[model samples]
Target: MVTRIAKCTCGQLQITVEGEPLGVGVCHCFACQSRTGSVFAALAAFGPGYRVTGRATDYVRTGDQGAKFRFRFCPVCGTNLFHTEEGEDNRSVGVAVGAFADPDFPPPRDSVYDCRRHRWVQLPEGITVYDKDPE
Candidate 1:
């Protein structure tokens, strides 16, 4: 298992990953774009049990599915760091790509919520794009 580390822009926060990410993707839902203050959000999904260090402020809100979504950010620098589903036994964590110390991180393997995707954005072909969560 290769270990990866990321530090927040302010240099006070650090995130470490024990192995390769479980998945990578971009989200285009209106709520996501609005929360991220961008056209879309890039994320690297990981399995449960990874550890994060340093203090982060959490913002919890109901998602499109009515499930609680929690976002963690640096209170001082306002750097968005992590996102997780708020419930017991939810086995996923999303690391914000921008928070990575490496600038050459690869692009996501998918783009989700394409139905709400901005008209000017063109996603890669043949990726697992979804209009919503596959259920």
Candidate 2:
């Protein structure tokens, strides 16, 4: 089983996920950019086979489509570790790829919110692009 660990900057919070992610994606929406403090956010979605350790604070926000998402971050380091769709049971968790700090981690297979993507940002070749979240 392939295992990957993603953690906050201060190591106060961490998540260990077994096997590969369900999907990897990049988002250029304003909300994502703001949350990551970058031009885009790269994330990987994992199934329920994962373990989380340490203390975290939660912030819930409604998406453009009105779906609520709960973001969890380390209170000590303030690293947004992961997020999940609200009101879902055992749904896939979105983990910040940067938190893993692995250069060999898989690249994003899809890009969302292309309308907001910076003009200078060039996505990987053959990546699926979406103007907004795919339904």
Candidate number with greatest lDDT: 2
Each candidate: what lDDT?
0.81, 0.95
Q: State, as a TM-score between 0 and 1, how close model 2 is to the true structure.
A: 0.97
For all candidates, what are the clash counts? 0, 0
Worst window of 10 by summed lDDT in candidate 1: 5-14
Expressed as tens digits, the lDDT of each residue in 1-135 for candidate 1 is 877776667867767777788888999988889878999998998787677888888999887777888888888787788888887485688898877756767678888898889899988777788898653
Error of 1 at 96 (Å): 0.6
Instruction: Please give the lDDT score at residue 24 for candidate 1.
Output: 81
lDDT of 2: 0.95
C-alpha root-mean-square deviation, each candidate = 1.7, 0.8
